[model samples]
Target: MNAPPYLSIVGWARNDGYTPNYAKRLEHSIGFLVRQLDRHRIPSEVIVVEWNPPPGSPLLADQMNGFLGGTSHASVRFIVVPPQFHRGPRGWQKRGMHVNNAANVGFRRARGRFVTPKALDTFYSDKLVSTIGRLDLDDRRVYRCDRLDARMEAESWLDLADDELLAALARHVVLRNGRLTHSIDWKMRDLHTNACGDFILMSTPRWHEIRGYQKDPTVLCLDSDSIALHAAAAHGASEVHWQEECIYKVVHGNTHAQRVATIWKDWQLKLDHYLILRHRRELAMNLRVWLNYPRRRVRGLEEILAPSIERHFVAKAARYAKNDTSLVTNDADWGLARESLSDRTVVRAAWDTP
Candidate 1:
């Protein structure tokens, strides 16, 4: 008998109004993913979904088409989610709606037995593909992995000291490990939850069984991971933390400080709204802890805290805030920094001034 076809990788690119580099970045990401998949000998396809077409944004679509044109992956396809309906709340745009819709469209068109929806901004290593390939798809299971450092180019403004950067990266490793080793496995209730949509692989049948994502057009500030997790759990799915290195670098468009401030502000608003809706006193309290306490304690806190707050609190507040527990409830590990001793690996600065 022929071996079963592997998972179908569905990627959605929602460029609200980005320039040509956005397309370049998307192409680069897709190329990297294709190469990784090829290395693993996994059958995969890339679906490029462009949403909310920007005025005079032909370059992005053209580039995407061009990238797909030369691909050898027989399953790859490109689609455009035409600007059809405005379902989101007034003044609040639904960025994920486009993604959900596009993925849904692709899901219908996909022939693979498994469907894994991944974010466009993520850059994956070969380990990611291998990890996904190794996951068990028979039972209802959710597999998750942690992210590596965000990739900041030499000219990017997010350049930080080697020690500081590694410290920040370590926090993610610690947090992910903490959640897996402690909370989720131990069944300890906590304020923080683990439901990141990125790097999560699930079977396609279960995906559609959950109705995919809610059609709430007004649901702004909500994350796709929380929705997926909740739906999966409600449908009798269990989550397992894959203790493998599936590293992906996040690319930031602003300075570390600016990124932190922006995240904090957004979390403040989201937590406030969550408090009113859920009426949970601990949520409000946890929001404060999430917003302030961790930042005050951790070194090189800017990089990890911003995204952590968004991932653990703001985006998926309902799931995390419902539980009043934390993975790291102490301050001892907060200030610890681990530095690499090897000088052979060159650590370049963010900017190379001529």
Candidate 2:
């Protein structure tokens, strides 16, 4: 049998066209990745988790095959998390992508020594790929890098030369030196949580030990990525910020942009509200301790008083954001490991190169 690959690249997307020319962006990013892996001779496998796919639309697997003209030198797998698993917490209606959950699905099934979860619309620099290819990364560290936002038209992306593309990407550095000043609460100490879901690399074993991302279904879509990073830190994985390497993200979706803008706009109001909630939660915990409440009563009170807060709330709390203790939120069956999902080997090389 063939050995497990050196790296596993996992990401999730559906064909809802969340961004204009979403398919084209996926094609460009995935094509770039395959080419880079082959050029570096990096033994890597790519896993694209098509989570909660829209019905009646063509499958992303088939679309990706068509994107590469049904061929690629590097190994690629398309794992489908069918519509049935799209339901939200407590029977809440299915909303947009369950970003963390989908990532967990791909991470669980990844067969590589080192696993990196990324977005389909982001392209990795050759330097970054080469660094990973060297395979000298320390297993005890979690690697992160800044995301440079490049506003490249999806359809026009394929026409750019490598030199022109990299030059254009260098002009827009969204998160510099691991700082997104306005993205998180000012009271909270900053860590490299900016566009983290786009590129978070660690050993496959470390990822499993952290139990993937927080599985809470109600945590706002934007905050979960940072929560995962905080959880990693809590699990005693040292942070290694890649100042030299960058992941260029193609700016297209308004969801993330708008969310950040809204937060920044109402920053003070949200901070006050979060403070109020935190006080109540702390009061309840103290009351429980003072009264020596029964375990069941304590749990009930805890559930009532301490609701889950946003990413910034975690940033302010050391229990989850620092090394006091390990934080493994998910159970042993994380990433829907028990489910019998469809895993397809979608693209196999039919040509020399793209």
Candidate 3:
């Protein structure tokens, strides 16, 4: 009998207008993985789910051809999905443009015993492959990410060479032993201040038990990560492993990590700032899911009605977006920082184990 694949790494991305940059970073990310997996003869699989092309943007396949060609220890696959699957109210899709639904789609197709779901902006360290290979698999423990910090934001990732990017990260990224770092912002310019990455790793069985990631429309990027973390904790996971710095993240203008409100450069930019209200809804949605998950699981009464609740805030966000339009052109409000919520509350791990 054939041995099963050891690990599966899954991520999805779509860049309708900026496919080249996304494509380059993707190639770099995968190639980095291949370098480690191939030499060690690790049986691994990489699945990229590409979806939703803007009006004239080429299909993700056309933009990413030939990048997957390799005869090695790991197999690479590309999947094209319809955008309708990701569409949400107020034209909101998954938090990261593609979130739980996209990753879950890849999970359903994965063939490895161990699996990792990562953000598209994530770049794995060479040691990560071997780390996963050596991890003592515990059904109750899920692995979380360690980030190396550097706020090396580029207008286009293609602007810097791989070597240059590596040099920049080496100058920063904090790595420590037997310590867990939570939510380190890699986009920070201070090398020592920010050094970390966020990624999730676990056994396929544990993932299946948790029913994969929550696709609640209100869960934003941060909430999505939290939901998975809490789900693991709530499901009787003894503890989670936190690895040393081995993942690098890049902050591009378009990625979720870099989407704070800013001034419009000109009239065209003001008109194109259409995603303002849409993005703000992420704040509302995240709060709803975080607060309600426990109530729904514990009380079983009314089930934390989300649709009507989401509609209630949708109107508020719409008005906020309209208010933002005035600032887009005016100098006064253009630079005002966007505060997602005033009293940011914590979303804890609350899943009850049977």
Candidate 4:
């Protein structure tokens, strides 16, 4: 039997107000993701759907159509969905939902056998590529990585200054394994919930079989991965945990307390409420103490120490930004580091389009 032709990697681009450096940061992040695919030698094409394009802005769909018309990825053809065909519910203002919808649009347009819905911010390992290779199409299993919070100490990188830059550098380093000796591990064996959309990989046929994301736009905090996993599970699809160190770098400058507070506020407003699902599945299973702890303790820490962490990150970013010749940028050392790490041969495959 012939191997699948391509891997449809679906992602989103935001039109929200961005800093001057936003495009560079986004490029690096997207580049990192693409590098992982390159590492696997996977012939893949990316679909970047836009949620809310600025008025008179070139249509994202047109951009995609142009890309598909021009670029070639072996058997894969990159394309973008026209905005006219893209529509979802309204009232929920969270970016996640918008991304989820955009991803679904990519999914519908994919002509490959396998469709991988990936977060633009996350990176992959050789292990992920190998794991996806073993999937049985008939079984339609959804694979999820045990997520490692890639939040590192800002001072680790010597080139960034300012809290934002430090936080960003710390995130980059952690995602790239700048610190920590061993990879963190997580398991969903006992959890009765779905996988995070950040890195969920599934077959294309199965994705369409489920009818894609709900059309109701009012659903906040709910996304394609949550809905897809649930649908797949209901269809008797099995779930497996790939416990390799897949890092998810959350680029937020808030503490756990702040995150909790944000979730609460968002939930109350009915804007984008879905933390309860996460709590029941991943957080409740692992960070039970933090979840069940008294509100007073959580609030106290948020008030007392969050400022310190923020300050440290700011200082670190500032310091690093001033020094471009930091040790972290030495490519020779990075090459050596890759060589010293355990040798795991990761093969990249083309996105499977049927």
Candidate 5:
């Protein structure tokens, strides 16, 4: 009998071209990942969640036939999340993608001992893959690594050998860990919370213990990943930052932050910045009294005063300054464990039965 997989890699995406050449990037990311795992002989499973797939577009799973060739060490599966679960409970209603909810769909179904939520366009370094392949990961620790942003045009190197691509892209390191390279006046260089959603690894059990990223769609698309890190720490999971291993993020034009930056003008940025400065002060006091604001009002404020403020201040404060010991955010039904969803085995390992 085949033993359970050593690790489960989970990521969520739609077929819509959200970023430039997104399909190509997704192909490289998953294909390279599968090849690397096979190179190291690691028994693993890759789960890609096709969350709220568009009406007239091809599903991501339909495009995986080309990615799974010559794959032996890892099995790949794709879960389809229907549109009903997209907006989430309490009528949150704002939707492009609910990262946490989509992730939960994969997390609840993962069959591996260890699980990590990754970005669709991310690539795992050889060093990182080798480390995980050893299966020496600790269930009591939450593993994190810094993200290196590469140039958008680096897609030309997609077919290059892994080491060649890695070496070629090393020069494009715009951000190392939390430090923004080639920046003269960016003061937000030291915060490790930057791009954290790209890679977060923890044991499957530990993920369940914390209930998989506060499924609150109300928070919108801001620092929920960082909050999950805090939740992990709160539940006594020690953080293990990988010093030598990091994930590579292919930078594109239409990311959430980049879009926000382009939309907000110089004056708007100044106004939002000032408002965030004040919001942080109020947040500190609110944390004391356990002050709570209506979700409607908060979302309205987010619309007016730059949602980036939630990422920078509100989440940072809740993660570091909060004194509560809440473990999981969703109810007992976290990850929609009870839902009957479509699960397709896109690529099975050679040892597995047809």
Candidate 6:
């Protein structure tokens, strides 16, 4: 019933071995959030839609449960829902769409004009925070930024001072130099763009208009970064003239100087392969057309793929209509039913992790 915030930063996390320095990284992220609260300027809030916090791991809920418990200025606000077992599309368990599913949970609670769905294992700068909270950014365009990746060791990160984090954020690690870059590097990859989870700053209504994240039982898609690209494309969106300001990212794994190469290499290759390669020219053409000058509405991927999916459904219907009695027909019928409704329980983002 209170006033809305300027921005609502949404993300998720789980305490598994897969994430390195999660406590520290998340602690830094929370600290960054606290420092960026500009009441007269950029009033903001943090929404953490946590799904599977492992035992012994720190919950943002417990950290910021004091005065501003349900508000944005709190250490964090949560929509701590349990994970549903419906991992079908793009191997649901690994594609991060589940975390995105968690994002939808927090998104429902957002009263801010803008929301940047991201991951918790990363830390960012105050500049990046302000940039994301822009109250006047065009709703017609999806925003993205390049992130600088780094790593650290485990310690009581919650105690670190902001000065140390500021110094660390200024540092960068690129594969070309094998050390921190002498200058900043944050640009969209040429004509073919690949926005990451942290890169996007979408308007709340735009997020809703796009209908959250895309899903299919068989597709490798929807990380926080690429969702905007695909959604914009599906809606006949603007070309990718993304911001060029560098954003810092904590890698959250091994601090082994030697492992730095492999760690950053894997990440770079991930961006290159997924955002650049894969569909090659087809995706490039699609993105280029959408991203082109004087951008106007055009046929989006939804238009192209909807019929394909419908054709599939129609074909299956014909089979069933033809008295086909097989697992394929039964499974198709079941899949259609499942997609129409929400399975997991829904709750307000202001709720605690119960």
Steric clash pairs (candidate 1) = 88-217, 150-250, 154-350, 190-323, 190-325, 191-325
Off by over 4 Å in 3: 18-20, 93-96, 153-167, 172-197, 218-222, 255-354
User: Local distance difference test, per candidate?
Assistant: 0.47, 0.69, 0.50, 0.43, 0.71, 0.47
Please give, for residues 238-315, the per-residue lDDT of candidate 4 as tens digits: 766556635454444532324433213333323213444444444322332333222221232234211121121222
TM-score of each model, in listed order: 0.59, 0.78, 0.61, 0.53, 0.80, 0.57
Q: Which pairs of residues have clashing backbones in candidate 6?
A: 20-252, 150-251, 195-225, 196-225, 197-225, 239-291
Q: Would you list the clashing residue pairs of candidate 3?
A: 147-196, 147-197, 148-173, 148-196, 149-173, 149-194, 149-195, 151-187
Clash count for candidate 3 is 8
Candidate 6, residue 21: Cα displacement in angstroms equals 3.7
lDDT of 1 by residue, 201-289 (tens): 66777666655544433323234455555556545567676555554545454322232333345666676678867866555655554
Residue 303 deviation, candidate 4, in Å?
26
Best by lDDT: 5
Off by over 4 Å in 2: 66-73, 90-94, 161-163, 171-177, 180-190, 253-255, 260-317, 348-354
Q: Compute the lDDT of residue 275 as modeled in candidate 6.
A: 58
Ranking by lDDT: 5, 2, 3, 1, 6, 4
What would the per-residue lDDT of candidate 6 be over residues 109-207, giving only the tens digit for each residue?
666777777665555565665655455677676666666665434354445676576565465344211112211112121222332555456677766
TM-score-sorted candidate list, best first: 5, 2, 3, 1, 6, 4
Tens-digit lDDT string for candidate 5 (111-210): 8889888897888888989899887989898888888887746557777877877786677777676622422222222334566787778888878877
lDDT (Cα, 0-100) at 323 in candidate 6: 35
Please give the lDDT score at residue 116 for candidate 2: 87
